[model samples]
Each structure stands twice: as structure tokens, then as C-alpha cells.
Target chain A: DQQVKQNSPSLSVQEGRISILNCDYTNSMFDYFLWYKKYPAEGPTFLISISSIKDKNEDGRFTVFLNKSAKHLSLHIVPSQPGDSAVYFCAASKGSNYQLIWGAGTKLIIKP
Target chain B: EPEVTQTPSHQVTQMGQEVILRCVPISNHLYFYWYRQILGQKVEFLVSFYNNEISEKSEIFDDQFSVERPDGSNFTLKIRSTKLEDSAMYFCASSEDRGQGHQPQHFGDGTRLSIL
Candidate 1:
């Protein structure tokens, strides 16, 4: 099912620049959205999250923006570091059920 | 920091053999879930367990697949009979109460199962 989708398979950015990742969902019932970062052989690490009630949520250098009208969401990491290079996944869930619908993930490559 | 633990990082079994994947979620976490990701694909949810019973399951979780919390600490997923398509990386995750919004689930370094 293509409920969630990450159109970009890969992204490249400078180490000290801003990195933006985009995601789209077809299901409007999704209320909670989360971003995860994963290394080559490790499980996904929770990064940031935002609820449908709010349009933006920021933590440190990570910010998640949600556009309910467009059924789209984006993640922005300021001053990207080399360690930030990994596959980023955007997930969405409905209410309290917590069954996460995941995207194909975008591989971020930070260049120094 | 507490983290989820999974056993047998890599498992190779015959197509008709039965396989059991084990996971130990973080302490104090009540909600548990199982998900699998095939090569070059998105992660797909299999099942979610809470309060000693299944709360939700996806279509991918067929009759051949089952989950159990045999003891107080460990949760397991068993495949009755494996098929070639059963090869994938299985991940276990846990979280606290679901009533609260934005409770991010903690995931374990998944177990990779390869059906021969």
C-alpha cells in the first residue's frame, strides 16, 4: 500500500547546510507523525515528531512541519553533520492505535 | 538509556522449517510491536500486543504467524512454516501508554531471517 511515500530515494547536502526531507500521505486519518533516522544495520532511531493539531514542532536543530491541508510533512535539520548521514523515514499513525505507516525512506548524504 | 534487545542477529532456515524470533523490550514499556522490512522496501507492521493480548494486526500477519509473551519479560514471534518470501529483517519495538500523544516507539536492532 502507498499510504505513505518518500519520493526522493537519495539526497546530498553540505555538512554545514540545512537538509530538508519531504513526505506525503494519502490517508487523512493520520494524526501523529514521526521522523526516524537509521544506520546501515541498526533499527530506526526516533528523531522528532509532530501532531496534527500543530503545524510545527522543533527540537534542538530538528524541526518537523506538517501541512494537513496538503497531506504533506517535512523534516528540517539545520547545520547537518557527517554523522547525520543515514536513511530517514517518515511515519504516521492514527489516534492512539499506534500502528505506524512508514515511507520508503530517503538516504541523506552529508558532504564535508 | 534502556534499549530493546533482539536475539540471533541472523537466522538461516529452510523454506519449510519453523522459526522463532525473540525480543526483549525496554523495561517499563507496556506496548510491544513486531514489524518486518524486505530488501529495498518500507517497513511493514505485523502485529501489536498489549495487556497480554493482541490489540491490532496487519494483513501481512497471516494465520501462519503468531506472537506471544510467554514470560513476563520476553516477547516472541513464530512462523509456523517459512516461505521464500519470509526472508526479511524483523524489528521489535516498545512504547509506554498510548493514551498520550506523540509517544515515540523505541526499536531494537532487528533480527535478519533468511529462508533458504
Candidate 2:
């Protein structure tokens, strides 16, 4: 079920530049959204999250913007570094449910 | 920082053989989960465990699959009869709580299961 989608299979950004990754969801019941970063062999590492109640949430160099009306969300990484190169996943949950619906990941490559 | 951990970085099992995957969730976390990802697919949720019982499970979690918290520290997933399609990377996760304002679930470096 394509409940969540990350249209871009890969993204490239220059070092010290900004990187934007987008995600869209078709489920209206989803109220929580999260962005996770994963290395080749490691599991996903939680980066940032936004609740439907808010439009934005920021953490250090990472920021997540949510547009509920359009059912879209994006993750922005400012001053991207080589260490930021990894696959990113967008996940969503509905109400108090613990099950997370995931999107096909986007591979972000930060060039030096 | 506390993090979830899984045993046996990779496993190879014969078809129809039973295999069990083990995980140790973060201490103090009340919720635990199991998810799997095939080579070219999105990570799919299998089941969520809370208070020593399953709170929710997906359609993929059929009669062949079972989850158990046999001890205070370990959560396990057992597949009664393995198939070629069962080969995938299995991940374990834990969250401090669940609700409208829920905490993020932390994952471990997954265990790769290969059915031969």
C-alpha cells in the first residue's frame, strides 16, 4: 500500500549547501510524521518529527516542515556535510497507533 | 544514549526450518516493535508489543509468526516455517511511550535473515 511516498529515489547536494527531501502521504488519518536517516548497514536513526498541530519543527541543522492541507512534508538539512550522506525515510502514524507506515527511502549524497 | 540492540548480524536458514530473532530494547522503554524490509521494499511493520502482550499486528503477521517477551530485557520473533520470501532484514525498535504526543522509536542495526 502506497500510503507514503518519497518520489525521489536519490538526491545530491554540495557540501555547505542546503538539501531538501520531500514526502507525500495519502492518508488523512495520519497526524504524526518523522524523518529518519540510515547508513548502509545500520538501522534508521531518528532525526526530526512534526505533529499535525504544528507546521514546523527544528533541531540544530535539520528542520522539518509540514503542510497538512497538501498532505506534504519536507526535511531540510542546512550546510550539509559529507557525514550527512545516507538514505532518508519518511514515516507516519495515525492517532495513538504504534504502527508506522513508511515511505520508499531517498538516498541523499552530500558532495565535498 | 540508550539504544536497541539485536543479535546475530546475519542468519542463514533452510526452507521450512524454524528460526528465531532476538532483540533487546532500551531499558525504561515500555513499547517494543518488530519490522522487516525486503531488498527493494519499504520497511514494513510486523507487530507491536506492550505490557507483555501484542497491542497491534499487521496482516503480514500471520499464524506462522509469533512474538514473545520471555524475560525483562529481551523480545523475540519466531517464524514457525520459513520460506524463501522470508529473507529480509529484521529491525527492532523501542519507544518510551505512545499517544497523541508520542516519542520517537529508536532502532537497532538490523539482522539480515536469509532462507535457503
| DockQ by candidate, in order | 0.74, 0.74
lDDT of 2 by residue, B1-116 (tens): 89899998899999999999999999998899999999999999999999999999999999999999999999999998999999999999989876525688899999999999
Q: How displaced is residue A110 in candidate 2, in Å?
A: 0.6
Query: Where in model 2 is the C-alpha error above 4 Å?
Result: none
The DockQ-derived docking category for candidate 1 is medium
Could you tell me every candidate's TM-score relative to the true structure? 0.98, 0.98
Q: List ranges where model 1 is wrong by over 4 Å.
A: none
Worst 10 residues of 2 chain A by lDDT: A92-101
